[model samples]
Target: MNVSLLANSLVGSEIIKIGNEVNEMKRKGAQISNLTIGDFDPSIYPIPDELKEAIVTAYNEHQTNYPPADGVLALRETVSGVLKSRYALEYNANEILVSGGSRPLIYATYLALIDPGDKVVYPAPSWNNNHYCVLSSANGVAVETSVENNFMPTGDQLKPHLKGATLLALCSPLNPTGTMFSAEQLLEICDLVLAENKSRSADEKPLYIMYDQIYSLLTFGKEHVNPISLRPELRDYVIYIDGISKALAATGVRVGWAFGPEVIISKMKSLLGHIGAWAPKAEQVAVAKYFRDEAQVDTFLKEFKGAVQKSLDTLYNGFQEMKKEGFNVDAVVPMGAIYLTLKIDYIGKTTPAGDLLKNSADLNFYLIHEAQTALVPFSAFGNDESVAWFRASVGGCSLEDVYAMLPKIKTALSKLK
Candidate 1:
């Protein structure tokens, strides 16, 4: 029999709908300009000479046997050092768990912290996984905060969800919206959790925090602030999740880590021991070396920052040009992260039965059939109730490609209106 509950609740992404439509149109001989990608574009950026050399050097030579269950010992130590270096927060190697990707690390943390019917707080327009992961695999509750407050959660705004939640899943430089809370605001939320925890006993439920900083270092003009930096004394309360996927553009490398209290990380590692166990021996060795050399890490950061900034600028200018051309676009320039969140409400729209069109999903479908463009709806990221919004992953597109897509974007938004 087919599985019921979480697995059954998992639906395919809404953006894929537009993408499949474009593919069908292309099959019918309609030319379509593609702007709907979420990963980095293929560019000829010089890969770190050392990492490349190491990959070749370490090939099959490393302990090719099943690596340690919690990941290679050396890699865990290196990740520990990285945590300390980045935020002056220290972690024992035992407190860090290696994972296939940040997604697994996130899912594993949810498994470790959450139980049936537990609530998990997330802001609207976040990484689609923030809620979907909880709902799809576990019997946890997904609570949505609005986009009106710039998508960052105020404690009061979040407390209702946080009330009985086993954990709070958060993303800085959020997914679709690319918004982040200030360092102080982050502490305020953490403080609220502590206060809330104080109201209960040690035997009572404790709400943990799974704070994702995968996009932490990729900020554009703004200071890339981290919450751990605010109050290192309370480190045990927060689980810091991150990986090389965003930093080194090594997404497929599938290397990520979870750093948190021994109790939480221990349980997560126990789960990983059964699920993914240690990372690939070679990749772990490579990432360990990559983390060890601070100079190399700094050099890589410098180059990546430049490339991502240029990409963000290209997106910024494209949206500005669209605004100038009379399209009502809400361009929230992300200071960091690899996406552009656009709200195109000016397009004239109506339902098929002639009812006025409403919400991002309606606009998304209109764009596909009429505009011949494919982009994910903001609702896919958990926005709801008539919020008309869209997101494009311009991480991989060139400035030229980004510019060329605007007319297509306008055409798509136009069809909906």
Candidate 2:
């Protein structure tokens, strides 16, 4: 069973492990309200009809061949226009590199920028930057953030770590917490990055930023901000990760793009090219045609985000109600994305079965079995196991499911001593 050290030491995804447990329970006839994975159940949230039809059309037109290593030029052009129209950021097609999904683009970013033992600074409770650092052989620094900042890292917390870092990974409408960085918050961090880079010699590797805004379009009412937009001078140092996976409920469609300095993007392109990670030609073609109609895209977002918000609101309000009822539970207001940050502070409590709820994971599994509900603990996202926070993704459940699960959770908690 000897394998490469990298393969042997690599840890599997904790979220996926929880999801697999949920799936196994479901297969055994358990009616589990699985909120572990950050994915949409197509039944509750289907892709836009226009986009789906375009995908079919592209396939019918025989766009089934492998796409160019970077991406379909038309799709890149459409992405360029999207940046201009949506975010007021400007990046031409050549500067954009599209891949199967944000994962490949993210991994490519790491491979292009990191060398073994190079430091990679990222906030704890982020999506997968820790694993990406491991895969890229970079020394990962997970800065612990406080709930006061909604689990998003502050400049002061990250400043001391940026001294010799090769990459600073950031995400807004951040995963796990569904929190976002305010303009002031992001601008502060951007200034820090600028200052750090300014102090570096040209011969030394500059600190690059990998900004993941995959949920940028999924915001509730808050504005999504980016480093480049706040500090235009930092444009060449940032690489953006975005796509239709979350925006269009098209995770399976596998079309994501990264745009930055042409030189860095070209390096990422070559890296991904060798890995054969291009988005399917048909899907790329379909996305290009569908995204060109801004009005149509806006119409879809208006309705889609409305549904996602309803689910998030239901869960938030339910937890707040429980808190008012003297439960040791709370929730952050839904800001963006399909997740609600929940505080189920029953870690030290004991279940009626006399088993001590030792940590967030234990409490989570208790709810899964007793409440028939599931969630991902912050520990899975790099926090200490004692942290009682968890992420409940609403994309897999309907508003009714969320409403129904609240009473079950209340009942389950009531049974805990």
Candidate 3:
């Protein structure tokens, strides 16, 4: 049987590839309390009345024509203001490019810059899509740094893999574990990459850095971190990926923007101009309108932080109780994103097939079957060696429900000694 090499190299998502097998069990009269799927609570963030009005107005006004290739002028202008206010980044509208979601922005970045066989570096147990997107779309190798160090990666990790490298996709206040790099730590990385780029010489193109700030508004207690803040000289080499999904709970609208040097944005926009043709015209107008009124962004951010904090507290308490109950687990506390990693060891407990539970994937399946809870195994996130670590997303459920889900999770592994 003949198949594509890239397709062969790609790994499927254990979390979703399970294909509703558990969900089907859940449907057939089973009490399924879902702890999987990192969806925000539907109640806290409903579509705003203003956005509804905009959509209707667009429909009535027949604003249905294809938009400009880059994005609507107002949206790009608003994005410029957002970068200035939030990250202290001075971006012109030309540097702002919009896509359906940050996922495409990643691919667009890869398409805009990468040559075949370029080496790409990222921190591990990362967003699954980044790895695949680089490998499948760009045919680039992904250099993964271990998450054992509280998920803060260093330049040393990239040294061995920089031979033909072109892009470094970085996500802070990252997905899965929610860890953010300290300002100093981010500087350490950029300094090294830029130095390495110089040593390699003028013939070699610069190593592009794409910083994903999708969860920018969700940070609580800790200061917001960005590479542009520290390394001003690398402005041309940096790309910022941010969105209103988490900020406005508008994930359904799939709006995200990229901020970078005008040249890179110009290249990416040329590509997106053909396919995306301005990010959802109606949604762009609404965000643009809202940008004029800072009060909405401010109030929404406050509520967002509050809702996220309440959920984090509930999950923290859940882990604490489990610890008190003698469960062997580590709390990988996150600074921003809605989820955190829980490392569990189910060793010596034995498995149904007489094979000892060996890795995170096995434990994930067992929990979903026996515990009736869904977790994104570290295995899915590219950590296969370690056993019994999985993620719990708190924002998807309310505080009480989050507390309630913990006991259900504990139910499966309680018998372990």
Lowest lDDT 10-residue stretch of candidate 3: 134-143
Residue-level lDDT for 251 in candidate 3: 77
Total clashing pairs for each candidate: 5, 0, 0
- Give me candidate 2's TM-score against the actual structure: 0.99
lDDT of 3 by residue, 144-245 (tens): 555565666766776676555677778888777777888877888889777867778777788888898888778878987888789888887898888777
Prediction 3 TM-score vs. true: 0.91
Per-candidate TM-scores read 0.89, 0.99, 0.91
Looking at model 2, the pairs that clash are none
Candidate ranking under TM-score, highest first, comes to: 2, 3, 1
How does model 1 fare in lDDT? 0.71
lDDT of 2 by residue, 1-417 (tens): 589989987999888888888889999999999899899999989999999999999999999988999999999999999999999999999999999998999999999999999999999888888899889999999999988999999999999999989999999999989999999999999999999999999899999999999999999889999998899999989999999999999999999999999999999999999999989999999999999899999899999999999999989999999999999999988899989999999999998889999999899999999999999999888888999999999999998899999999999999998
